[model samples]
Target chain A: MTQRSIQMDEKIISRVDLLNICQDVIEKGNTLLTPGVADYSVVKDVSNLNLDASALPSKISYKSYVFPRTEPVLYYKRSKNDVQLIDVNIDSKKIVILGAKPCDANSLNIMKHLFNWDYSDEFFNMRAKNFIVIGLMCSHFDEYCFCTSVGSSPVSEKGSDIFLIPLDENNYAMKIITDKGKEFITPYSGYLKSGDENRSKRITENVKQPDVAFDSSEVYKWLGENFESPKWEGVGNLCLSCAQCAFVCPVCHCFDITDEDYSYTEGRRMKNWDGCQFGNFTLHASGHNPRDIQSKRYRQRVNHKFRYYVNKFGEILCTGCGRCSRGCPVSVDIKEIVSNCKNDQKELR
Target chain B: MKELIKHARELLENGEVAAVIGYRQVSAKRTKPVIITDPEETSALVFNEYCLNNLAVYLTKARIKLLCKKNDKVLKLAITAKPCDVHSIVALIQENQIDRDTIHIISFNCHGVAKDFGFDFNGDNLASKCITCETHKPLYYDALFGEVKETPQASDTALARIKEIESMPHNERFEFFKSEFDKCIKCYACRAVCPLCYCQRCITDKTIPCWIETSSHQRGNFAWNVIRAFHLSGRCTGCGECDRACPADIPLSLINRKMSMEAKNLFSFVSGRSLETPTLVGSYNEKDNNELFM
Candidate 1:
């Protein structure tokens, strides 16, 4: 890599100057991601520069940007003699996602293993490479948050290019974590000054790990042995088998491919989001479904997150962002469900 | 509340039912659906403004079969029902989805359930169903608990909202629904929570020359939502469970309420009003209004 004239170092940017920086980033032909309003009063992405101060997790995670809900892989046109296949070009533009929580940042780390396991998903791989995540240290937590339980913390800089710690209401102390982060900050040297070393130290001391803790291995062991346990039947009785958990989860990456045709002559093969909790997810062409009951479907969901993923990749799939628990209409708390696994006889009421 | 619990315990203790389906306190503010097979566990059951779930949905053959598998004897269920929930049970019986004899209805005389479990009702906090509900006492019951409350007059707010949507220009209304449905993640929470949407195979799940797209984009979302509302047109009991259960917070009630009004006006039919009356889809008559069909 060629060394740039601007030194890569810690910088201080005031809240007032941050808007200008965001605009500058946009003007330089890079995408600036900030929290805005979505449908149903969800605060997610704003227009250009105005970041929503409400730093609660976005109802839909940023995973959609990398692994979209629906995208066409290829298109085909049939004529009398020939069929022409057309490949869709992927987006290669750089994205700078601002105001990401540590939990949100770490989700990319959990999902990366799947995209690269047996085959490289160029769609996800290219997007993941092109984007730079700027993680903001969390200052608040709600009942649903359990980041500490899943091996992440409020101030974790695991998957971020740049990590921001709030020094006061107006100023932020930015820490460069990767070569991309260093390169991105070089252009903004005018807005930055040498940040205070003690500010970051105080932030590290002040932030507390979330109180939720569990023996994940024990839960995993219980899941392995309790495939046909009667406990699953009772536990999942109230479940709607809805995919709210999967949709809102930061790391859930299951997809289904289908061909949609506008006419007999033209069509596109599309990949869309699919969830294990759905009743038809495991339906077979032989007119049979092995995971026939809601309990079995619900079991597959938790097992995939906490047990199967761990056994396969040596990592748990969830980041404990708490979006699933928060968004579920029935309020099925994963923390409560996983904790109850240790005690087989415990009722789920 | 104590009377309901006492009755539930008595029913469970005597083996009159396999399980008493009711609401149990999950948190200080939330109550979730609980099935108590053990008579001693009846104390966990509670009823108040916080009990918003329509427990009548569990009266399906599939779930009832689960209770029967535990014992060789027939599985008899007893459910705690609010007025609207009782309407759901009547609707289910009308369609032959449930056998009225196998289940016992423990109806409660309720003023209203809150819009959200976390908040207390102050007129505004009552659910949309409660706002228009006149059924303070259950229409049918095997056993009644709590004193009967005076029935409140129906509110015009729901109908007025539908009228407002209808008055919008064609393209604007299209855009309005397009934006609303665009938020759908296709999780099927709406259908899953609905007591009447108990189809064993939902239309969206069929993949052999797929009838409706399962994707969550604008066109797919519109197809799935419109078809679901149409399927529940006259049969829906105005429970507002679908609207409440939607994670996207889509105003699904407006569509259902509009269909309900059209049913009442055009067909002279009111669903779940009585177990004797057949549903709109089930029975046809030569005297029935045929203007819309022509």
Candidate 2:
């Protein structure tokens, strides 16, 4: 693993220039992109913005850029003699999610295993394999932000092909972790700067976030013994079952597939995001809903993250991105939820 | 819930009820439904808020089994329900999906059952749904257990998160959601879990009509999710199940809440109260404005 640091002149090849650079790379048969739309990342002002590309700016969804909210999973057509299958294009373009946060980028591994495990889903894999992810460290915290608590720091490299650390004026300390990123950086060797290991290490300490801690080791045993705990019903009753927390969570992975019909014979199966917050998540098609009560549905969300995911993946499903807390409509904080799950309540039971 | 199980066992043994329909603990604290015709299996019964699954569906399935299937004796069954589960039962009854007289309902003093967050034990922390329940009472019953109490208030949206996002400039909030939406892998957890989303056929899946396009494109994804949310306006129960079920982690409640708030302010109706009442869009009134629909 030869790690090389680079000094990228902030303005030599501007983000817009990179768009052209991407276009040139594609012209040379290497699919790459400075993915943005006029409506999506076009910032009207950049006085305080430091990231290269702004994420999508509407409730529309970025999953479509990769997984797409809906697409023809496969298609069928009636012919004179026999039915013909029309396969939707599953190949994906290579693009750089240039300014992804560590939480979002690291989630790709979870996503990868999900689509790759039972059935190798070409749809998600196509986009995943092609995209070269570049993560930028967070410098400040927002009110709903809580990434550090879930074992991820702003500068965390748990998931990313390339990570960029903003250093002193006009420089970025870059670390390439994957061959995909390495290949992309080869042509940009001119942008390389000698290693400044001190500055690079300091980047992790530079982030600002309100520290919220919990003993990660205690989470599993507490849940194992407290299935009958009354605390769950109390907090779960407040839940609206809207599915927002999972929607924003970087690691929450659950989905369903369906078919779309264009005509008598033309139809496409599609995949879309599913959440356990809805009432019938566990409902048997026979109609029995295992998690019928709202409280039961709410409990599944927390247990899935802290208990179930750890049992299976040896890692928490959550990255402490705080996106769920920040995005929740009722203000349910994961930090508080995790705290309640601790064994401190043995006396209360 | 445990005492009732004992009674159910006796009834099953003596042929008082042809079958005792109830739940058995799957693990130390988890449970699964069962129909016991034998008295010896009665020892498996247990109760608590974790007995959260709705048994209404079983009521009908049991009846159907009685008619076309195995049993020769007249069937009577026992089951438990929470308020919301009762609501579904009432809806099913109203729709003539099930008969009430043939079944016995042993509703519990629902201490709001915790939700099933799909996680394994990490050592200590459990899911949040188990911690924040509202109602603790079961409103319907042929028999009761523990103690009846009132349910509390609940809403899925994280108020602090909403406030924080709301405080940001409109564009910033939009950007935040846009980013989240962009992350969506379109796994469809939201639709699959929604109780109100029951339709033999959903419009979004009709390619002939193309109610929605099938592209992962930003605009298309936004339209697909928003349209699905809007369709549930005044109909969504705010269970937070869809969010918990999502694999790609798209925050669907933001869409659900916007509709819920809009429905509350505009229509003055709440969903899942008594399924007898049609949801907002199911019926029509002269006092309604067609402007919003347009």
Among all candidates shown, the one with the greatest lDDT: 1
Predicted candidate 1 versus true structure: per-residue lDDT over A1-349, tens digit per residue: 1112233456788877776767677777877776443221222323444333336666667788788888898999999999899999999888888888788887777898999899988998888888888888886677778888888888887888888888887888888888878877777778887887677778777886678667788888988988777788765787888888887788999999999998999999999999898888988888799988888888888899889999899999999888787666666788878878866555542
Positional deviation of B16 in candidate 2, in angstroms?
40
Model 1 / residue B278 / CA error / Å: 1.4
iRMS of each prediction: 1.9, 11.2
- The runs of at least 3 residues in candidate 1 whose Cα sits more than 4 Å from the true structure, single-residue gaps closed, are A1-9, A26-31, A36-55, A79-82, A347-349, B69-72, B147-160
Docking class of 1: medium
Per-prediction TM-score, please? 0.92, 0.54
Reference contacts recovered by each candidate, as fractions?
0.50, 0.08
